[model samples]
Target: MEEQLQATPICGRHRALNALMAPFGGWDMPIQYEGIIAEHSWCRSSSALFDICHMGEFIFQGDFVADGLEDVFTFSVQTIPLGRSRYGFLLNERGGIVDDLIVFRLAEDKVMIVVNAATAPKDFAVIKERLTGGSFTDITAATGKLDLQGPLSRYVMVEVFGEEVATLPYFRFITLNILGVEAIVSRTGYTGELGYEIFIPADKVGELWDLLLEDERVKPAGLGARDVLRLEVGYSLYGSDIDEETTPLEAGLEGFVNFETTFVGKEALLRQKEQGPPRQKVAFEVNGRRSPRHFYDICSGGENVGMVTSGVFSPMVGKGIGIGFVLPELAVVGTPLTICHERITMEATVCELPFFKDGSVRG
Candidate 1:
């Protein structure tokens, strides 16, 4: 039997636009409207709106120390200042990443956790089991999330929301009024651009979506463009780049893992830190515009060394960019590599992250 797919509150709006719809993370989502490349290009220069309400949201209110909330993730939750959000991993006992999530410090005793759609149930279960005491509840069904991303995102957000959004600062959030409801607006996004993520009641999502589209500068972009945008910046995709079998150390996300803070998988991570991760994530660029896709073989010295995880032909870079795990020695920048799948093969070179660097993310 086929599984039922969930729909966001803005699903009708997407259908009305005659968007190309498909299943993504167990939800019926729009893959594109005008087109993938066009939307991707628009987001790079202007702004693109994404319906992200399918993501999971959880509310936890309790003592950070006494309730074991402080040690649940790779980062220290108790130390996150109010109005700020911290990104980190939820790991398993073997030091593998269960999910990469963000914890928003909503109040002194309350925090909101945002997680990927497909991994939400498992992430919530692991968090609940790890905690000895806390008022934790899933709020995904009642909450809605929209990501307005790109160079012009900040300007659009300020114009629609208010002047308070103008200086929200990266990683910080402000509670503001929108459509007669309280919404949490955060200066954070996955596109490696200056952007905002708006969290509001599920019922009001369509109104906000419509309201934002009223601006000629804002257009709806689907998952296809989102994938391209994220890959161009070398951001890791949850299931594709990092999963329960991949650790943060191997994924080049050690900076997010606080060694000073003891948490689940700390011992294993310590062991790997001393012994070194057997394989490391590498960012590479193809010699031309031919795209490398997921599961493509990464070759070196006439042997398959790794497999492509997240990949795409980036319009911004005018070439194919991809991230994959390879032998530690082959992860070095400037190393020559070959990406192959079936009859297609392309020469590539190990490169540093953020394949496109001129983004207005800091602006």
Candidate 2:
């Protein structure tokens, strides 16, 4: 039997705008509006709004250390200062990533854990089971999220939400009243641009969305554009670039892990660190405009070494770029590779991350 796809608070708005809808992470989501490339370009040059309510949110209001919340993620939640957010992975017993998530320290004893939509159920169960005590509640149904991203997003935000959001540093947040309700505005985003994530009540989301789009500066962007924008900055997509079977070490995300603190996957990661990972993540650029695709073989010396997990023709870079797993020896920059699938083959080279570096992410 086919599963019923869920709808976000902005579903009607998306359909009214004639967006291309598709099932993503169990939700009926907009894949693109006018077009993928057009939306992507818009986000690079101006402000782009995204419906992020499909993602999950949870509230953890209790002791960070005594309640066992500190040991839940790769990073320590107790160390995060109030009004700041931190990104890290939730790992399993074998050091494999359960999910890549962000923890927002709303107060001394309260946090909001945001996770990818597909892994929310599993992540919630895992986290609850690991905790010895704490009041952890799934707040996904009650919350709505919208991401406004681009170089011009800050100006648009200030004009609409007031000047209080103007001085928010990256990874920091401020609670502000909007439309008669408190909304958490965080200076963080998936797009490699200056952006803000607004979390409001589900009932008020449509009003907020309408309010944002009323300004000519903001246009609605979809998941398709979102994927390309993230890839240009080398952000890993949960199901594609990393998963429960992929560890942070092999995914090139070990820096987010704190070995000083004990977590569920600490011991296994320690062993892997000592032994070195057998395979490593590699970022590569295609020599031409041909795009590599997921599950395409990555070859070296005429032998299959690994497979491409995420790949797309990058308009900003004017070429194809991809991230794949390869034998550790071939993960070095400047190494030549061939991406092959059936009759399609393209030449690629292991390159550094951030395929497009001139972003307004810090501006």
Per-residue CA lDDT of model 1 for 223-264, tens digit only, reads 999999989888899999999999999999999999999899
Worst 10 residues of 2 by lDDT: 353-362
What are the per-residue Cα lDDT tens digits for candidate 2 across 226-264? 999999989999999999888999999999999888799
Spell out the clash pairs found in candidate 2.
Answer: none
TM agreement with the true structure for every prediction:
0.99, 0.99
Q: Least lDDT summed over 10 consecutive residues: which range in candidate 1?
A: 354-363
CA-lDDT, candidates in order: 0.95, 0.95
Evaluate model 2: give its lDDT. 0.95
